[model samples]
Target: MAKFTDHDDYIAAAPEQFRPLLGQLRSRLAEVLPDADELIVYDMPGFGFGKSIIAGYAAFSKQCGLYVSNAAITAHADEIVAAGLKFTKTGLTFSPRHPIPDELVTKLALASRRELGV
Candidate 1:
């Protein structure tokens, strides 16, 4: 993976097909977490709150991922499955053909911020 100095660098370096998706995710996260500091954590773009990286995102070869606290994931697992998306304990993976909804992103980001108590 290429070294990214910031979110713009990471999004610019991503595959052409995923750039728009990454941009949309970034916008949604920023909208929901206006007070959170934007930063790079674990090589991915993340929103930092109360000394913790509460949310993050990354683009891979065929998909992009939105990562939040495990509590957020568990709380929204049913909705995630209903949306026909796949997820791990802390990440939801999606592609252009099956993009994650902006509403869901907002919910997850808010939940993450709440978890951080910030």
Candidate 2:
């Protein structure tokens, strides 16, 4: 596995099966936060707002994740859980095979950006 320095590098280094899904996720975030800086934070593809990390995503063997804090996603808790996805204090987890809802991803990323007051 290659070290990733940017969002594109992170997505490119992900498992081939997950690349497309991760791309969709990254696109959604970019749509919401066009001004945010894309970088690797906590070893994942993340967006930075000023000095704070607004959001991030990662792929694993069994699942893919859209990373946002609990406070950032609280507004969508019910909908996230209703979708049969898992939302912990850290972020949301969904099956890589089952693509994450684009609208939700946009909303959460925007929420995270808002939380940063950026």
Candidate 3:
């Protein structure tokens, strides 16, 4: 794994095909969490509010992820499924072929901010 100094470094280090998707995710998250601090934790890019990371995103070999609080995942599980995306307890994964919707990203970020009380 590459050691990333910041979000730009992480995105630059990702595979070529995923760069644009990662960029889009980063922008959407930033738009929704303008007051949140940009963060790099566990080598992933995230947005922090208060002491907690409100949202994080990553580009893996096969997919990209949007990570938020568990409550946010639970709250939007149906939308995720409806969009034909896959998700874990705290994140959703999508490939370029099936990108995450912008509206869903906003909802998840907002939900995470509210749930985390940040």
Candidate 3 per-residue lDDT over residues 1-118, each given as its tens digit:
7888889999999989999999999999889999888898888899995458999999888998999999999999999999999999999999889999999999999999999998
Predicted model with the maximum lDDT: 3
- Which residue pairs of candidate 2 clash? none
Every candidate's CA RMSD: 1.2, 1.6, 1.0
Model 2 regions lying over 4 Å from their true place? none
- Candidate 1, residues 1-118, lDDT tens digits: the string is 5677899999999999999999988988888888888898778899885358889999999899999989999999998988889999999999999998988898888887788777
What is the Å distance of residue 95 in model 1 from its true position? 0.6
Clashes of each: 0, 0, 0
Name the lDDT value of residue 58 in candidate 3: 90
Model 2 lDDT per residue over 1-118, tens place? 5578787788777878888888888877887888888877667778876547788888998788888866777988987877778878769887764666888887788787777777
- Give each model's whole-structure lDDT: 0.88, 0.80, 0.92
Off by over 4 Å in 1: none
Clashes of 1: 0
For residue 32, what is the lDDT in candidate 3?
91
- Top of the candidates by TM-score: 3
Model 3's alpha-carbon lDDT is 0.92
